[model samples]
Target: MATPLIEICVEGIDGFLAAQEAGADRVELCASLVEGGLTPSLATVRAAVKAARIPVHVIVRPRGGDFLYSEAEFATMLEDIRILRGEGVAGVVIGCLTPDGLIDEARTKALVQAARPMAVTCHRAFDMTADAGEALEALVRAGVDRVLTSGQRDTALEGLAILKRIADQAAGRITVMGCGALDADSIRTVRDAAGLRELHFAALRTVPSGMAFRNPHVGMGGTGKDREYELTLTDTEAVRATIAAAKS
Candidate 1:
């Protein structure tokens, strides 16, 4: 079998370098992984582009939680793409949807047009669309080079069947990438069952906070069970393991 394209989702300079060193075909640079990824700072994008031999694709999300964007938020995303393109990134990841849970074709087309020369991967927001079939068609028409999805489910394993269908339907018109809760088993499943050549995952592992003193009463972000103290970063070991498993 041909080697699969492993795209590692990373948040900073360290993660980017780790992914390249570990043999990732590309790196999807984002921030706020807890919120399902937001746009990283321009500094991070610049550094990642300079430091990596593999391709670096920046996420164009203004915020997390929803794929729908306000006019201003959409504008910000376009500008971010422009800057990344100038910075010599391999591509940009983007998604835009309407209020009715369909691909916002016009807006998406504009974004893709503005992002000329830089490949665009419609992000997991494809899963949130009302109809996966319709959404896939719209993305194709909008000139998206790839679509990253969990097959319209929370994780790729659960949605392997739909993922397979998408790959067959796309027929190489656009790349279908299986992602979400990915690991060796899930990646192997996509290769065999879904027949996709691209895989995406974070490979995140947590380490204890650097803080010597703790204030149990105060939370820096989130709340209750959703607080941050540990640092969740991508591990190079996990990346190497994933590539080995995919090839196996």
Candidate 2:
């Protein structure tokens, strides 16, 4: 069987390059993976686009925490989108919701319009919506090209049922990209259950920090601690496994 295409999420320039080299179909570029993924800087966005052989989709989140955006944050998001579009990005990944956790159709539609000529992906904010079914319809109506969801659960494995439902409801009007905690072991089950064509994961592992010095003053437990950055590097083995499973 042929391998299914994989879209990997990258945190920085190195990760973007690695994903392309490791056979990713595309990359979602963002900054501060620890914060879940806030919008990347203009320089980083441009660099990723220039460095990547494949398409690069920049995340347009102003800040992390919630999908709800303040007036200033919303304005920032729009500005970021314009900047990235000008930089020749393939698409933009963003999501906005009302305070009540419902898709903000008006705001989302406006963003979609501003992102002309480039695809728009409604991010995991769909998982936070009050009604996944209603939100799916709203996103489709808003002209969103795709949605990144974990089935409204914390991870794809846990949310397979809901993810499958959303995929069925989407009915080809839009794509339902399964994401979150997707690895070689579970990729096959997710693909089988969701019946989705696209899947997302960070083929990255945490590496130990080389720094030996300990900041005792900053310790919550008053003891020296070890910390590591969540860096993105394509794990060829993991990617190969996921692709194989999808094809099966």
Candidate 3:
């Protein structure tokens, strides 16, 4: 039963070519997903890594609330992870904390050793940790390769029992991704009760902005939710029916 990987949280390059033509398997790449995601313009990560074929995990997040950062926003997140590791892009979704929450581990192990060999996720800020099994063992001692939780509750099937106790305390040493508000009927119940191999979502919807002219008043994301003409992409058949309901 091994088929669950399906990551998909896009925002640019047309939601990363509509989540890689609706097959997704990876494609976080972000930028102002309504302030929940930021950082996304090394020319839209080199045009989604030259219109990638899969794997495109970008998201250095310079802003959008808090994960605590200051020294010049952690040196602009280490020069945006050395310019998205020289645009070879394949990973980088970081997190940093410590205004007394934990897991700052020297700026998260110096942004996971400057994101070498790419592959380094830790979004959802690990659900704003206060201690999810000590921030999943401080993101497996700061070498994090994955994590995009919802087990902090608010979705992911209301934190499917803390994502099955952080996937049984990450028995596989890290890679539990069961995101919030997952769709296609809740992604096979949070990937079979959180034994999840990996799965994040964003099969968005909300279209309506081929404006020909209409200014009823005003509202440019000043938190009034007028959403300039509205448009939240990523819905290639709802990412092909949530990857065919996580492979049936």
Candidate 1 vs 2: which has more TM-score: 1
- Cα displacement (angstroms), candidate 2, residue 69, comes to 0.8
Mind giving the per-residue lDDT tens digits that candidate 3 earns over 23-124?
Answer: 998889898798888988889889888878787988898988989988998899889998889889988998888987777878888888988989898898
Q: How close is candidate 3 to the true structure, as a TM-score?
A: 0.33
Global lDDT scores for all candidate models = 0.89, 0.84, 0.86
Instruction: Please tell me which predicted candidate would have the highest TM-score against the true structure.
Output: 1
Give the per-residue lDDT of model 2 (tens digit) for 1-248: 23555788878887787777767898999887867788888888888887878889989988769988899999988888888779999999999999998999999999999998999999898999999999999999999999999999988999999999999999989999999888868988888778888899887766655566656456443223444322335566666666666666
lDDT of 3: 0.86
Ranking by TM-score: 1, 2, 3
Candidate 2 Cα errors over 4 Å, as ranges = 1-3, 212-225, 228-236
TM-score of each: 0.96, 0.90, 0.33
lDDT of 1: 0.89
